[model samples]
Target chain A: MEQPILSIQNATKIFGGGFLSSSKPIVALDRFSLDVYESQSKIITIAGESGSGKTTLANMILGFTPCTEGKITFNGIDLNQMNGEQRSFYRQEVQAIFQDPYEVYNPFFRVAHIFDMITRHFKLARSKKEAQELIEEALNLVGMRGGEILEKYPHQLSGGQRQRVMVARAYMLRPKLIVADEPVSAVDASLRAMILDIMLRLRDTRHISFLYITHDLSTAYQISDLMYVLFQGTTVERGNTAKIIEDPRHPYVQELIDSIPVPNPKIKWNMNIKLPSEEVMRMKNTVGCRFYPRCPKRMDACTKAFPPMVKVSEEHEVACYLYQ
Target chain B: MAANEKILEVLDLHVQYFTPRGAVKAANAVNLYVKAGEIVGLVGESGCGKTTVAMAILQMVQPPGRIVKGEIRINGHNIVNLSEAELRKVRWRELALIPQGAMNSLNPVLRIREQMGDAIQAHEAISARDLKARVLSLLNDVGLPERVYNMYPHELSGGMKQRVCIAMAVALNPAIIIADEPTSALDVVVQRVVAQTLLDVKKRLGVSMIMIGHDMGLQAQMVDRVAVMYAGNMVEVGPVESIFAQPLHPYTQLLIESIPSIRERKPLKVTEGLTHDLRNPPTGCCFQFRCPRVEPRCLQAQPAMIEAGPEHLVSCIHYQAR
Candidate 1:
């Protein structure tokens, strides 16, 4: 494969975790690294619970937030050192789809205004006719017609329709990467498959890399090529989705997978759940392994220091003393 | 089935919402029942009237939305015909509702104990010491710490707040509890914990429950029987094992297949179109627009629920024609 199109090198983000703070600061992301190659389009998923720092990572990748340590590069160009022109170009190349489709647009404006603004700002088309043609083409790519969507307001469309319009706007820009944060969580389950299918088609036809962030392990396993499991603020496991989901080495990853309530009734769950104590969860000091309080298989060394990331295979990696 | 075994029953329940455009038939001839100490899962998409049916059960349907016709029998009393004063006594004491977004249902200014005490005092008179004991025991039952009784809603996490909601719903020992989307807003791990908490509370209190949610996986794990709804109509309902194993209704079959599975990777089976608009629903079947097995007869008249197997009922013309 060629050089990765986007690379996150040892990115560490600390919120108010600086010097001279009376309260304990939050370590949102700690020494996390990932790379997305543009050789062929693929999906990279970040999976975790509410406080696992997935959103923080998405914001950093979008350049809205900065990392305390390490760097993010696009096409071998450091994002932090980019000039104004370069930063604007980066914005055009990288787009995002947020969780709530209802809040994605301004309700007062017509839906087509969004596409018009994108084309005008990027200088993608010269005239009104050219911009209209471009908007229609992008809408068609997402299986929607222009006439049905152009003159309507945001409130008129359904949740699924609004989300597709957001996707169509991203398509209009011809971006190389799209970061979707729980895009289908608000939509009905019947429409989830369609949204996911559209995403898969985008990757295949457009050769556009996607940084899909969600807490749903099932959908991540279904569509992701690479998966990263985060606990607290650190990556506990990273590998091929099939291998990682089928044979999770990290204890937190295993629990997340097990808790996905299979649709089959025969596979009953063990009701005796082991939850982490609130004291260990709310502790301020950064001592040993962050998952030591909830890990089913804890070791003495795990408490002494954070475990080193070990290679399970050429593509699989885990951070735990047991794996070592 | 014996008369007393049926703790709650809704027969020919029709609820409509009169909008400026037209009268939306939110629920149409929906029939369901919950036996003593049994849990029934009501599964459907949004705008399918799952929540409307639940609201009708509690007699809390607001203006412009009324139960047009129905018999809601709870503990041998017809609640539909009861007076406001009579219904007030049966509201929380007989049928309790753990509403959607219940985590935020707690008052921000008051302590947790005050909220639970309000729920209990609204029904029956209890001494202050007894109320505290009851609140602590309910909190303990849901795996919450005793210290939470004094903390306000803002101090608790999302899962903790939901647990408090569950504790409040079952405080007065209601005969039936209706939990509408109880775990939809929670994380996956915390969702499972909350699901487990519901099961534990049900076992301890022996309260019949009607759980409304869109996730079939959680329903399969929790409910004793499953009821599938589409566009305000009951499509199919049966034992959980039987419904999941051999779903008769096409919509129900498609819904079960659409759920993504981590155990094995396969292409998801999605329904053809979006759910129908309630205001202008088709004259025949509620799911005819999205059903793959639609026929000429299906477009002419609605199919009645028929026994497909032992204790299994499905409302599809294809299944009924055979």
Candidate 2:
């Protein structure tokens, strides 16, 4: 049976505060919802271009930005209702691997400080000796050997090695879920595959769930089990990764997929979707479709009323007027 | 002196960077030839010394980076030993550079037209009217609308800005254009469009080009020949089909397998170890550590480029003489 590990409901995140805040809230996430199941919890890649609300949704999952409107419940513990201790416990279970591996570690601190972090917070090991053992085990899990790696500084390591170190740091806690934000973008092209392979192996061996966040759709399609298509802060499509990629239904989804460089040099593909107009910017205040301005098959009512998520099959759901 | 056939012939070029760590040899005795009107693709991963080789030929190395050995002959002139005064004549009118991350390439405060006009006027003694006409024509050739010339850099999209940069590069109609990572950041559709424009411009102007990029797949599309780089060294150089279809270097083979192609659905076989460190690059074969087919002798000495086949050169000792 498919068992859901976490279920997000009607989540909304609006950034900024005080007098500088604009009249219309910058809707980073608009009433988004999705269910992540344990059986197929290998990786759920949330990918989009910059300002596509991919990072905002990732922050909501990480508990960094509390959703303004709705709830994110992890194993039935409502994230909003949780107190400080409970939140910290939630963090231990759901670790975050942010982009820019250089920024993840403090420059002044030693590499061993990472182990100290897991020790001071989660009490991840049985004793000091056990903790050292665990750190070594985690380092080896990400394909880095123990003796040579831990003593080196982040600057001393290559981009790929440093990224792998971050993965190792996350492995130290054996967290059930990891929210990795563009983890491989900083690394070189050759090393990106190595890091991705490690993550996949971890999912199979350790039964860990991952919320892999990225803007590179090709890499996302390579790894993700389930995927979401977010455009300008709203979920346009969500379904099985293979199905959505093989035959994208939404116009935006099709466009994003078509934009990827294929190996074949002969075929020229333009998704043929036009950019949103000035009128669409004015219609940002409308109640209905956020993608109304750019949608190819848009109707009058689509601008007046928000479309509901229509189920295409048991595993697919699309939020578009055409589908509805 | 005619510029009739040969544009540049780089013979046994070697560049080394003297860091506090050690002397890292960037361009490990590379040799290449560019015809008067042809495109050669220099393909590799980032930090593979592709940029180092390009900069060394341009004589733009700062401290800690130097071209220790070899020759860079451009149009029968030894560029390696050219004085600063002699090289100034070749800057735009002879060969121009279209570097990566064009967002930083353009001047922010200046209008697009002014920036482009400045390049043309600096190189040629043309009237303002003639310069304007040339700038507008160049913009049209690169597929940018005439309005784009009037707008500032902030007003344009990434693709538009890159197109403008291309226009600026071709303003003087140089004999050779070294376009480094020209379409890496662009979306696939936009990348194709930009790449097509570049090819079209190169064809029309009859200018040779050195197109440098990080992926073998991307390079295969536009370039006639491909040169693979790894940790400041050229590992393989051959025709594009040979590089992709029958790669001689084990590293090149691994790279081909790793890219997610339209045909292959299986997860790519990622190279296990990280790239070689630039500061303390290993002796002998830089890729000796992670090579799946590494032999005992590979650890001891670097292999010279050997004839793998017709027009194919490889630097793997395993394929060389016993």
Report chain A TM-scores, every model.
0.97, 0.91
DockQ of each: 0.77, 0.36
In candidate 1, which residue pairs clash?
none
Q: Per-residue lDDT of B1-322 in model 2, one digit per residue for the tens?
A: 4454778888888888787778877777788878888788887777778888778767776678887888888787888767888787788877788988875789999999899999888778999888889999999998877887798998876777888888988988887888888986675546756777888898898889998887655676678788888877788888777777788898888777777654335865666665666667667788988899887788887788888888799999988874
Report the lDDT tens digits of candidate 2 across residue range A1-324: 655668899898876653886566677888888787766647987866666688888888887778888989987889878888888878878888878888877877778888788777787767888888888888888777767867777787777888888888887777888889888877776788888888898899987888888777777778878888787788878888877888777777776676665644454444243354334444574477776776667788787877777887766778777776
- Across A1-324, the per-residue lDDT of candidate 1 in tens digits comes to 589878999998989845787766789888899998877788989988988889999999999998889999998999999999999999988999999999979989999899888888899999889988999988988788999988999999999999999999998888999999999899888789888988998999999889899999899888888989888889999989999999998988988888888888898887777576567676733667888888888878888888889999878999989978
List chain B TM-scores, each candidate.
0.97, 0.94
Off by over 4 Å in 2: A1-5, A14-25, A38-40, A75-78, A264-308, A320-324, B1-4, B274-284, B297-301, B318-322
Considering the two chains of model 1, state its CAPRI-style docking category: medium
lDDT of 2: 0.78
lDDT of 1 by residue, B62-130 (tens): 879999999999976889968899988998889999999999888999999999998898888899999
